[model samples]
Target: MNLSVNVQEEQGTAVVYLAGEVDVYTAPALKETLLPLTEQSSTTVIVNLSDVTYIDSTGLGIFIGALKSSGKAGSKLKITGANVRVKRLFTITGLNEVLDIEEDQREEV
Candidate 1:
């Protein structure tokens, strides 16, 4: 699977777009991508998973780890654009209550 990341900064928020499958082989890269941003400042991080096609346990671990790390650092992490399959994973795993996930709304401010 292919992985692509795009980062945008706005009003102290860091928006990251994740495109592709997140599995054991690629979860490390995703963790690496977020570490620097999380360490830089106490910015609210929004990870957009609209384009993510698949995710494995390792992928889920990275997000959970990031959430803990961000919490300790006094920052917040939000997950957005999770498709039905992904959302089901979160629900089935009881992760939906642990992570902050938002719906996709095209309007921009």
Candidate 2:
């Protein structure tokens, strides 16, 4: 499956909306788009995964890299709208504690 990423800016936050699978083949695209945002000083980068059905280790690595960059650049990284399966991956990897993730109340149909 292909991944689609859409970015938008609201106030001082950079919101990234992702759809489809995030794996080895599509992780590079997310990294390219997200890493740069994380480098911005005093900025907030939010990754929305409401429509993201699957995410692999490679994709999680990209988020880890982005989180590190955000720290050094004095930016903040937030993850939101992750479905149950994706959230479980983070929990299992212990990244759920390291990264700021906001739960959305939307149920997947």
lDDT of 2 by residue, 1-109 (tens): 9999999987879999999999999999999999999999999999999999999999999999999999999999999999989999999999999999998789755
Score every model by TM-score: 0.89, 0.96
Worst 10 residues of 1 by lDDT: 100-109
Give candidate 1's whole-model lDDT. 0.86
**Each prediction's RMSD to truth:** 3.8, 1.2
Task: Residues 21-71, candidate 1: write the lDDT tens digits.
Answer: 999998988999886676655699999998998889989999888888887
lDDT by candidate, in order shown:
0.86, 0.95
Stretches of candidate 1 above 4 Å error?
104-109
Q: Itemize residue pairs with steric clashes in candidate 2.
A: none
Residue 54 error for model 1, in Å? 0.8
